[model samples]
Target: MKDQGRSPRKRTGGRRRPNHKKKKHELGREPTETQVGDQKLKVVDSRGNTQKVRAVTTDVASVADGAETVEATIENVVENPSNPNYARRNIITKGAIVETSEGEARVTSRPGQDGQVNAVLVE
Candidate 1:
């Protein structure tokens, strides 16, 4: 008697944790990009969609000269130990320079925090 719609959480309930981490091709050799607060990334969303989105930092700005592609330069990243969105605490971070389809933006993330990241600045 189960409804037909997809459930909010994964359907499998018994054994939750998977054995290994499934890494995507884009996320290069770094445990997680959350440490680099503001870094814009060119991302392909769930449905194979591509967009140049901002990282969650102050150092990046989308190129406004009608550029087809987006780019961002990285400066530094800082973590807010008191961030409520974080697991034990919350988090805040910033990036250097960034460009994207929606212009460009800085981005940041915290482990065991909210469900997703925060895209701060964009051009």
Candidate 2:
């Protein structure tokens, strides 16, 4: 598990001893790495009695063109500003340009976190 706590080093570049043990609220998980494929979702328990839906894989996206929103089939990832490797691996994330049935669109939502891909049609 990854730690979401503060750094172990001080601002003065000195090592600081941990004040307490790790807590559940300070835990972190790996990225979902949502891909273009059959729809698959995972529900996870979160803090404050809430739940998070993660998209493991999906093949459809909601593309907004001007004032209209339409569902389109996701073809493949075109480019990803977050990571070049992500584009090559076809991992979908926010701000990624994807080829859809409607046309090329820029992702406007976090698929892994939102459980769906929302995008804006690109000219």
Query: With candidate 2 superimposed using the best TM-score fit, by how many Å does residue 4's alpha carbon deviate from the native?
Result: 3.7
Give candidate 2 regions above 4 Å deviation.
1-3, 7-17
Scored by CA lDDT, what does every candidate get? 0.36, 0.93
Report the C-alpha displacement of residue 30, candidate 2, in angstroms.
Answer: 1.4
Tens-digit lDDT track for model 1 on 1-123?
222323345666644444444445434332223433444343334324643343332333233344443344433333333443432221233332233344334444432122234344543
Candidate with top lDDT is 2
At residue 6, candidate 1 shows an lDDT of: 38
Error of 1 at 94 (Å): 10
Per-residue lDDT of 50-99 in model 2, one digit per residue for the tens?
89999999999999999989999999999999999999999999999999
